[model samples]
Target: MANLILYKQTDLSDRMTVNRSHQANGGMSLFRTTSWKRSFVSSWLLRLSMFLLLSLPNSEGKAIWTAHLNITFQVGNRIISELGETGVFGNHSPLEKVAGMVVLPEGWNQNACNPMTNFSRPETTESWLALIERGGCTFTHKIKVAAERGANGVIIYNYPGTGNKVFPMSHQGTGNVVAVMIGNLKGMELFHLIQKGVHVTIIIEVGRRHIPWLNHHIMSLFTFMAATVACFFLYCARRPRMPSTATRRRRQIKADIKKAIGELELRVLKEGDKEIDPNGDSCVVCFDIYKPKDTVRILTCKHLFHKACIDPWLLAHRTCPMCKCDILKA
Candidate 1:
């Protein structure tokens, strides 16, 4: 009775070990399956997000809200287009046309270190306009000095080396009524005109212009996408097989040529029929006149040639040698 109880206990322990092993294996398999599915979903979502971000344009980065200057001056009763360069709108000014008399600084000494800085003042009887030259100081320093002198508007001209290109100006602590930068060439033109007692006026207006770098990149991306789409549609719509009309026409042409060759009249030429002229009436293929007793073929176009001479020509070209008329077409 003791041996029987021990055997039964050992058997029950073995079955429980086997059941635990099977359960562990099944659990591991389920975990692996779930992990794989989660990984795949995460990868797909990442790719989709990247695609959307690239396809859409960021409005803040690409398009900026700014204003432009439309400067015009009078030249002897004629309001010509004196607007040489448009200035980027400056800070601290309402987007309206600020018209003022153009005035150059005393001694034209616009250097920031110069003690005699002349700027327009509101308290003055006339509107004071300050014209300054670029360089010798930061734009901020120049504008700040001019503002201290109570200038209504400040115009900075480019240095000698700087080309006729207007760029956006940024200055710190410059209380601008209206601020603008003109190209060296345009600035000199206006300066000499003012010196000659010619009155000039500038108009600042709110306008839109291209933003740097961002606009270019966006346009390039759009162009690339457009080209890619065009190519894809062309490939999808392309014909894989030869055109039916062209194939059918080629077959008909070949068949007609063969039938015409079969129905052609072949005869042996006698001495009387061999009265041929070498210069004017000669076989264009062999460039020889017809010989007596020679076997010849006459085309429907009335052109005659030796059988051997015309056979190869007709087989290759399917046309009359002299007239170039298509025997198949006829």
Candidate 2:
């Protein structure tokens, strides 16, 4: 009876300890979850800020603008015409449509590097466009020289050996001037025709517009969002699994059985003890008679058995060997 009371007290103590441990673990889990949420929010905000910064317009404060050029030249008795969006406007050029006869500088050098470069204009042609080579001076200086020479518009070609490559030129302080750049190959074709004194006329009109930096911003934002979503799913998939209700109950029962086993009374058989008698019932586990100095255990049902044998038996069965009494209920 005393052993039964001690077993019950031990079981109850174990139950309280498990409950306190669970509560403490729950509190710590809540704190860690809260901290993780805060960190996730902060990380998202930082990514959003970077995305916004990347989405901003280019620092040059201007987007690339393309120009469509229509050219008509008289070859023999037939007039040849061609049209394509093969030109980019200068950064400071005015967005306007202009048309005129194409002309070159007065001297052998096609680049209007000299501030006093003169344009040979036909007496009958009221408006003419200056065709200049790109080199030897700043774009601003060339455009200014052409504009001051009574040219209606300016068209600068790219460097030699560069076939159809063109970019928007940075020509500040040349206000309201209609300046455009063509590829070196295209420029050479026109230059030869104009040099041969073939009458060439061109019509320049605004074409498509493009923002080069916008694509990078969009791709970066998509990558960041994808990574964040993948991380969230990975975390959820790897989180620790909680114990089921049935599993918890099974664990608690095992703990109770161990505690009861530890609380059972142990005794040593002596020479005069009845347990040492030859006529006494043998241990059900080992089928052996108890002898002097043999260790035995007393169960709550008043049944006895060898301590070594009953300890393993109670752990598996949790009951007395003879009467089948449950130690936990006793």
Candidate 3:
């Protein structure tokens, strides 16, 4: 009898050990799955960051430098002087300082598009700068016309209605020629002064450097990326904690079922026992006839089953297979 009890105890011990091992393996699998997902997302985000960085314009090129203009003219026996960083030089223009008396084209059209265009100034005037409008041809054509006529510098104004907005001109191949662009308003002011026969002179100087493309575009890209990362982390933080909690609950329920099964009555059937008699009812779970020395589990309803068949059935269904009696409540 002692040996039989020890054997049953050993069987329960083995089942508990197997259950713990299965739970441990399940936990490890869950950890591996979560880690792989996190790594994939991190790598994808890193690649997206690199692509954005590569798509930006090159920052190593020379910065666009502004030009400061200082204008001086005589107005009704008074000398007026104005100065501001209101001009931008041509892409190919020299950065060196230049000063000269301002002059205009000889006709109603001030664009200076005609190669034969001339400046109505005294031939003896040593250094002169041409003041031309924006449209009517390419900037190179107008600048070349002025440069060909021995003008020391060329100043092209922006289109009308542009207010004070100005941008650098791209007039390549105009070698060693000093060129600058001023806003329509500022250019019109200079044009009127020179047209009214008021002697006007301007000194052009280099101003501060700027990187407008880098400042505007790169900052926008950075803001978008930062917002995307913040949202991803917020989603991760708010997700429900499901894996550990569900696994722990299942383990606790399995332990309670195992303990309840152990508390139920157990019996060993022997010869002449009514349970082992030839006409006695067989174990309903397995539909097998009980013989001598058979281990049977007796439920509260007086129904019996082979221990091997009923143990797992009770664990899963929590009720006797024959009478539907609950072992834990009994």
- Screening candidate 3 with a backbone cut-off below 3 angstroms (N, C-alpha, C), the clashing residue pairs are none
Best by lDDT: 2
Q: 1-330 in candidate 3: lDDT tens per residue?
A: 122223334543555465456545543443454666565555445444544454344333446678889999999989999998878888789897988889999887999998899998787789888899999999989999998998899999988987667766889888877999888898898888888899998988988777655653565477668868876885587555434677889888889989988988999988888877677688887789999889998878888889999999999998988778887778
CA lDDT for candidate 1: 0.61
Which candidate number would show the highest TM-score if scored against the true structure? 3
Worst lDDT window (10 residues) for model 2?
Answer: 1-10
User: Which digits, one per residue and each the tens of the lDDT, describe model 2 over residues 39-69?
Assistant: 5545554544544453453334457788999
Could you tell which candidate, 1 or 3, scores higher by lDDT? 3
Q: Which prediction has more favorable TM-score, 1 or 2?
A: 2
Ranking by TM-score: 3, 2, 1
- What lDDT tens digits, residue by residue, belong to model 1 across residues 230-261? 65665455544434578889878778787898
1 versus 2: better lDDT goes to: 2
Name the runs in model 2 displaced over 4 angstroms: 1-61, 222-330
Judged by whole-model lDDT over C-alpha atoms, candidate 3 comes out at: 0.78
Question: What stretches of model 1 exceed 4 Å from their correct place?
Answer: 1-85, 91-96, 111-115, 119-125, 219-330
The TM-score values for the models, in the order shown, are: 0.42, 0.53, 0.56
* TM-score of candidate 1 on Cα atoms, chains taken together: 0.42
